[model samples]
Target: MEWLAPLAETGVARALIAAPTLYLLVNAAHIMGIGVLYGSILALDLRILGLNRSVPLHVIAGFLSRMAAAGAGLAILTGLCLFSVRPVEYAGNAAFLAKLALVAVGLAHALVLHRGIGWRRATTDGHASAALRLSALASIIIWTSAIVAGRWIGFL
Candidate 1:
């Protein structure tokens, strides 16, 4: 935690704190990143759940996965900068802790989904199995919950 204090004093952090408009812009970017990331994930999850049967699973998953990854990368970078502004307070915030935990779970779920045979089967078979649909449902719940928890950080 002591080491994190230096992060707040860094050049970028100092500039962000000094310039309210800059912080707002970064925060806006974070929101946009979240929208892209979660929106792509939700679309893919819906496809897995049999929403758009006409589209190929791999085609949608391949493109949306890249979009989600890019969004996540941008969100992570901006989020770290934002956190550096009030590291000590954020570390102690219950909502922040919950958000972090949810984020970790969401990432783990994605890892498992991508590595599992169910994903492969769903992509190749042109139809989702019960298990794949269940996974998609779980994905939707997990990602939505994570987003809710992230928003809660501001209130709590």
Candidate 2:
């Protein structure tokens, strides 16, 4: 954990930690990124769960996936910047650890869904298997948990 102290004292971290307004702005950006990411994810998952039957699955997945990716990129960049400001504290925070674990699970679920037959069926036939539906449900749960854990980090 002490190793992270050096990182927290780096130039970028020093600037961020020195400027409270800058830190707030970055935190705001991170929140916006989370909103975009979760919004796209919820929309896509809802479609898969039969909420928007009129829209084609491929259409929904195509654009939303890209948006989600962009949001994820932004979130990750800002999150890292924020982490750099207090690396040792975050590294040891229980809520941060839980959030990181949930993020991994969410990403793994997305990978499996994209690479498996569920994606194909959903795109081609506009229908998904029960397993796919379960995956969608799990996505909602996992992502929501991650968000919750992230919020909990502040209290911890």
| Top-TM-score structure, candidate number | 2
**Prediction 2 TM-score vs. true:** 0.95
lDDT per residue (tens digit) for residues 24-105 in model 2? 9999999999999899999999888889688888777878877887888889899999999989999999999999999889
Structure candidate 2, residue pairs in collision: none
lDDT of 1 by residue, 1-156 (tens): 666678889888999999999999999999988999999999999998888788889777878988998888888899998998988888888888888888788889888988988887766666677888898899899889889888888897
lDDT per model vs. reference: 0.87, 0.89
TM-score of each: 0.93, 0.95
* lDDT of residue 65 for candidate 2: 78
Supply candidate 2's per-residue lDDT for 86. Answer: 86
Best by lDDT: 2
Candidate 1 least-lDDT 10 residues: 120-129
lDDT of 2 at 52: 67
Model 1 stretches with alpha carbons more than 4 Å out: 1-3
In candidate 1, residue 115 scores what lDDT?
90
